[model samples]
Target: MIEEGIVAFSGWMTNFELLSSGWRAGLIVFGLVFGTATVAFMVSRVIAAMERKFIETRNIWDDAILHAIRLPLVFFIWLQGVYWAAEVAYYYSEADVFTANDALLEIGFIWVVSWAVLGLIKQIEQVLVSPVKMKKPMDYTTVNAISKLSRMVVIITVILIALQTLGYSISGVLAFGGVGGIAIGFAAKDLLANFFGGFIIHLDRPFKVGDWIRSPDRNIEGTVEQIGWRMCTIRTFDKRPLYVPNATFTTIAVENPSRMSHRRISETIGVRYEDIDRVSGIVSDIRSMLQNHDEIEARQTLIVNFLAFNHSTLDIMVYTFTKTSEWVKYHEVKQDVLLKISDIIIGHGAELAFPTQTLHVADSVKLKHLEHDFGRDQGRGDTANEAGERSLRDNHEEAVSQQKSVEKHYAKPR
Candidate 1:
């Protein structure tokens, strides 16, 4: 029907002898351009109505399909219209540039179709991952990985097809790529490593976005914000952004605290040595308290024992886990447990230990005697003090002898 209309229009244009070929071509070009705009507008309006209608339906595929094709369809229409107008111009002007019209049309069609397919893939990925759109939303990481792989495949296929359309052999391209791949791999070894690291992460599923992960091998303690092909972004405790290469994860061991079942609260409390008799009772009371506490995980390793006797204090170990794993809530639970332990100790009439020291000395007479001897040594003064090593040694020996004699005088028969 459209061909017949065009033929009738051409016949009608030929009947106008007054109009030159250039003028007729110009009119046709104007008509084509105006028609393309009108067609694009109509298609957009039709797609908008279809989108509104499909959005209400339960199936999401229709919406995705309509959305993906809307812009690309308009573009395809414009391309065809312009192609036809250029053909007419070429026929009249015999231009050399328009000779590649067929290749350009094929390439443009491939590009448009690839664009639509990519758009559809992206839309489907979004719909699957959106909690509001899907009843059971898919994992964002998995969906993203699949979407990326699919898009890459689509892109590679499109490129190959475009090359074939431009008179390039697919087999030759593949052979050259296979041979050049080795050199490319060597040149971009790190880049390839990071890429493969990301791929492994996607497959292994060690940690995902929003997981609190820390690496003992590296100073990487943060919540995962974004995981990309080359690097991962982490938000640290201090709210700083850290960009780490994906390859780094391949070598390091990551601890995902977010996946821990419980947070440990291991502490050693000590009491004064005087509370030796009360140590057992305190330990028992602490264990009972932990067992009855709402926040403590009694089913796990609950250990409250008198660990050891220190110099000034008796050590009591409190090793247990909290029922909660949230960081802030875990601290609160730990604080409550510690305060309860303190109360239990106080109730048991035991005091927490502190560092202390005691000094022992001889009787007052011995002290005075020592003081007198020290004064006598001072009285020997600068002459003995300034004496050479031999003289000082002789004086020290003399003092020792005199002190022994005095001690003998004060000694009793017993």
Candidate 2:
């Protein structure tokens, strides 16, 4: 259809034979420009319709291809139109300005082709990482790495091709690059290290984008936002962005909490010394509770035993794992487990421990001391005795009040 249109335009141009060559060339240039615009517009509309149609289909390649070629196709049309126009003008006027027309056309074609390929790579990368487009989306880090490497390969190839087209010898260019690479590598050694580090990360698959990672070796604890060639961006818990060099991951030991199967719940509950006899029963009930609980992972190691005789309490060690690795949900499960344990202790008529001390004295010693004090007061007279009695009564009342306050502070809900 395009060839037929061009032939018809040629027939129409021949009708202006009476006009001068310059006038003929100018008219042809105008015609080519108009044709280019019209063709480009039509192509864009067609591609848009095709994109909408292909989007509904399960196959993503058609959509990606259509999207990739839209702009480049239009550019190619304009390039050919302008090249033809210049050729016509040069043929008529024999101007030196249009001498590089062939070279320009070749270079332009290379650029447009490379541009489309790069666009296609980008589209495929996006499609693979999109959950809606793919049933099982590819890893973002892997897709990104592949896309970048593909684009780099396309660009380097285009550059070499363009140089060859411009009459530069391919072997000579390669030889020059080989000699210059050593200097370039040394000058950008850190950059090369970071790039290689990123490449290693992509290969090793230790952690990926969006993983919550922490490093004990450094203060790197955050959700990975992006893994770039030079640096990895992490968003910390406090919502601050941390830019760490990619090389840092090569040396540091990263803990990926996001990849954990379960979150641990390890706690030590202490009961009053008076409840020592009930310790065995309490531990037994706790172990049973953990084994039967819905949130706890029964398959994991679950231990509930009387661990130690603490100064003020009998400590029971509760070591278990929750079924979920989610931070908030794990905490909720832990809270429920702790509350249930508390209830079990209460049901067994046992109380949680608090610091306390008891002192024992012989009754004879107490009586002798009281008697001596009383005798001394009597000798001092009735006024001294009354004062002593009042002080003793105040002290007793104060002690009782303090005891009640302490009991109130430690009181638990039924």
Candidate 3:
């Protein structure tokens, strides 16, 4: 009986010890999680303050950086906290899974840092290349190439480092990758060519996003939307998106109409031939109007003169350039100037001409010449009819003479 009591007492002590350890571990986990939460709150507050300060700066890139880092920084802080907790558990707990948990937490931390780095690189690009007035805007093709290259470098480096840290042999992976690369190269020939073409476009910089481009090779005209590896996206004026292969830009001659300094307004105004006396006055007045107009470009070529005499009207050509290159403003200015020109023509009692053909007969010599020609034609017609009638009568007399000769010859000899 005394031995059974001793065994039962030992069992109770063992259970008590297990319960105590469980409570301690629970306390530690709770304490670490709570501490992490507190630190995260403090860090987020600091970042919010920094963001506000950055936004007040004149340079917009700084603000953009702050925004980019905000979420990543917070995420990193929490990831670090999880790593520390796992590290704590690994040290205290004698369990096999704890080691794995710690390793995973470390890897997670590395990945978060890598992700943050990528975000920073992308955000920095905006600061480095986006301010058109402060810095030269990067070419669309080149910018995309740089961004993609940067991302690849970061990811590959991180993966290699992670693999090395995890005690994996990289040589076999590299060998396998090399063989796979050859196969992929053959299979994706067009894709690779398009990627190479993207590189050329980046270097050449024929067009960029939002710039209007038209290809003389075919009927492709639109504003650039995005330049990518395999294809470029263009948004047309008709509110549709066009996808073009990047390789096409390398082969075709592209015209960047968006880069033009000014828009042209060349027009031909025709006036009635009766307004000949007012043609010179109208040309000079129109030239003055173009010069004095604020929208008309003064430095460019402005030609307003009586250009040609059409069959029905006098053509006065007005060729000039508008100061603005915008499509809407150019048309508005052109419409206003044309209306003013119309008003000027009307005030001078001149009318716009249309398609017409007029026969003008001169009273002096040309009229007499036309009458004499008509009489000659009529006399020729009368002579032709008289000759035709005389020929018919001769044919009748010849037939009758032949008939009488035949009758005399065929008659019985008397």
lDDT by residue (tens digit), candidate 3, 267-359: 889898889999988998999999999999989999999999886669989999999999988899999999999999988999887655333
Candidate 1: residue 282 Cα off by (Å): 2.0
> How does each model score on lDDT?
0.87, 0.87, 0.78
> Tens digits of per-residue lDDT for model 2 on 1-414?
433554465557778556665676688789989998999999999999999999999897899999999999999999998988787777667789999999999999999999999999999999899999889999898889889899989999999999999999999999999999999999999999999998998899888999999999999999999988999999999999999998999998999999999999989899988888898899999999999999999999999999998877788999999999999999999999999999999989999887654445466865565566667667777565575675566556766777777767755532
Best-performing candidate as measured by lDDT: 2
Model 2 worst lDDT run, 10 consecutive residues: 1-10
TM-score of each: 0.82, 0.86, 0.70
Give the Å error, residue 35, model 1. 1.8
Q: How many backbone clashes does candidate 3 have?
A: 0
Runs in model 1 deviating more than 4 A are 1-11, 359-414
The TM-score measured for candidate 2 stands at: 0.86
Among the numbered candidates, top TM-score falls to 2
Candidate 1 has a TM-score of: 0.82
